[model samples]
Target: MSKKGKSRKKPRLPEEQDLDTFEFRPTGLNLKWTKDLITVFDGYRIHRCYDLTFIERAIGEGQMPRSFVDQWRFIRTILHRFAAVSPKIPGVMEKYKRRQVVRFVTLVLLTIAVPLMVATFVFSITAIAP
Candidate 1:
């Protein structure tokens, strides 16, 4: 007699084998095929560029707002909205890169400019006092 506790396990399909982390990873043939196509057409004129770029979100924002999973998604939403206006590949990429530059400037402002300004002010005040 077969034991009731013993159960047969079913094999997982290809779809089920993927992990959640795989969603954000660059996989499959598109990247490789694109590189190959570019190599053939462009030859020596342009080098192959395969970049997996993602947004950077600062600390303390993770899971803060119930809606956003993280800052990356938040930044993505902003960039996506900005790109949605044009929706063309060239236009979207140009705008996205430009907007990313602006974002980087803003980050520098917060991390560097504001702190320097505060330090300068404090130093000037202390210098004037004594």
Candidate 2:
């Protein structure tokens, strides 16, 4: 086939292919959200601490009972699920949608009405004088 006549193939997207074959890894809360949350906590001078070594040690030493590990894994999965659901965009969109519509409508009316209002005031004053 001549190069001019041949069609170029598009690159494959891994996510678009079979999901079962894909190895999905979890990344913790995104940087912006984490930073925002940290800002709120920092504003109040709150301290946060976590010690995950205990879990590692328990697992390495076989001290973690099977049931305990199962429960912890379940809890971790639940937290990850919740984190997946909760984020800033949807909440922000909702907040703006709730209050912003009114603010925007008010702004639009003011923009249209201000000049007319000034004209009316000048006309009324001239009428009063004559």
Instruction: Identify the leading candidate in terms of TM-score.
Output: 1
Q: Please provide, for model 1 over 6-113, each residue's C-alpha lDDT reduced to its tens digit, 9 standing for 90 to 100.
A: 687984323322233434322332555446534533432232232213112312434123332332343344334444445454566787789999999999889988
Worst 10 residues of 2 by lDDT: 43-52
Q: Which residue pairs come into collision in candidate 2?
A: none
User: How far out, in Å, is residue 93 in model 1?
Assistant: 2.6
At residue 123, give the lDDT of candidate 2: 95
Model number with the top lDDT: 2
Q: Candidate 1 clashing pairs? A: none
On residues 62-121, what C-alpha lDDT tens digit does candidate 2 reach at each position?
Answer: 755555444444433433444444344357558658788999999999999999999999
